[model samples]
Target: MDSAAAVSFDANGTIGAYQIGVLISCVLLGVTTTQTYIYYSRFPEDPAILKALVAFVWVCEVAHAICVAHALYQFTILDYGHAERLFSRLPISLDTAVFFNALIEQSVLGFFSFRIYTLSMKLYVPILIVFLSSVRFLASMVTFIITLRLPSLQSYNAHWSWLSIAQWSTSVVNDVVTTAALVILLYNRRTGVRRKTIALVDKIIVWTIETGMLTSATAIFMIIFYLTMKERMIWLGAFTVSSRMYSNSLLASLNSREALRSMNATQVSLHSFVSRPGIEILQTTTTNTVVDITAKFPSQPQPFQANRQCEEC
Candidate 1:
């Protein structure tokens, strides 16, 4: 095989990295579908705006998957044995995929920002998050436009590297800020709470950290790979999967409400009877089972009261 062909298929090179990224992203798309389904089925009564956001993210993800698959097909199948085509202008599908990715990121980040607002009842922090997210999205869109005009992806790196840096740096900063804000707010809420409520708050903080870390870590590595190894498309691999992480994180957060509520109820039930054994303990459940962390952990802790059916028992 010629050197070009060999490099094209080199496991440590561009095509190889892109192929692997595509495979992982496709697998995560399946996960996205499942999470979307779970969110819709379980939380039918969620606020209309929240429901719309989930639907919009899912749709964008599906479109992104299709675009990514098309790009892969063009690279590996349609342009087989043509090394020049691999380095040629970007595929339309790939360009569209980037746009979809930006959309997904913006939506998910915005949703999280709103959640922070709900939790803290403060707009400054959430507003900052939204601002960062908007900048990232705008930069991505500008980059996408530039890619269309560039003769090759290599030329893009040559001319407008600063734009790429801006886009990715804002992304990393936004993720870190969002995660930190949620954790700090939740941690503050943890104070002056009983063991049961603290447990719930701790669980939420963990989830926020985990989800934030996954996306933030991916963004960090993406910029690193791009800056260091753009020639081999290593960054493309990370880019392909990054948007999916945001979507999954959002859905996972929404779906976890049920579990959180169940946990709170179990903790309450267990402790309510621990103090009064052999008493007929009848617990009344609230209809709102959805996990609203803001409601669960109020700015001021409310005294716990149990509605007992058998006070005379």
Candidate 2:
């Protein structure tokens, strides 16, 4: 935020902080769009609900970008050089943008809750995650209604700033808890599992942490700047892009499952010395049971006995 620019609120819709936030949000929308295309291309076999969620989030992002763009266009172009229009109270377009954030957050949180349920094999963490997500959504709704009820933006902020705080605070807490739970769940899976399974778990844990940080950090930044920089609109852009982080994080995970499949397909084996006249190697085939046979030449296929006897025995 430039010292001179912060004071100058002419055209470009307060081209100091709010302008940057909207532009950055548009950039993040592009990032998420690329990830969405890759997800559709690479993971055609993904679950239908997962596909639907991606599509919904994409639509929400498109709508969100449009709303922000409309606000910019209205404030800067239509009402250019009007100091009275420097800071909007509750523009219709900006108001529309707010609920979209809640929608994206709730959807992403629900998706992760299901993931936690799958990985943790229980509902405690998932329930808590969903609860936090619900609280955020409800807070946004209350904020929206109060904004409509209040006489002006200043009045609304004075009366209902707590709603905004609650929304972002819950979002931050939800992200931290969800990420920690997933990391712990993945860590626990390493016990009594194959090296390949352990490697996959490690990858998931890394991914979970990275995505979690992206969302949590953005939300925290939004809250901090919103509170600390009361005289400026710098926090507006941070809030604008926060939803994109959640949307992209979920989409990336869905698309990156390809890595897991590839990892599993790369077979690994250990070598042993039989110490015969010539090197003897034993090949084992299993189907719910194991059979060991001693053969002079390892190249010859050892017949399965239990399977053979079970045919008539």
Best candidate, TM-score: 1
The local distance difference test score of model 1 is: 0.75
Evaluated at residue 260, the lDDT of candidate 2 is: 50
Model 2 alpha-carbon drift over 4 Å, by segment: 1-14, 260-313
- Candidate 1 on 17-126: residue-level lDDT in tens? 89899999999999999988987787675556677788899999999999988999998889887767777898988989889999999998987787676555569998
| Candidate 2: RMSD to truth | 12.5
TM-score for each predicted model, relative to the true structure: 0.84, 0.78
Q: Evaluate all candidate structures by whole-model CA lDDT and list the values in order.
A: 0.75, 0.68
- Pairs in clash, predicted candidate 2: 21-237
RMSD of each: 7.5, 12.5
Sequence-dependent TM-score of model 1: 0.84
Cα error, residue 96 of model 2, in Å, equals 0.7
What lDDT score is found at residue 135 in candidate 2? 88
Count of clashes in candidate 2: 1
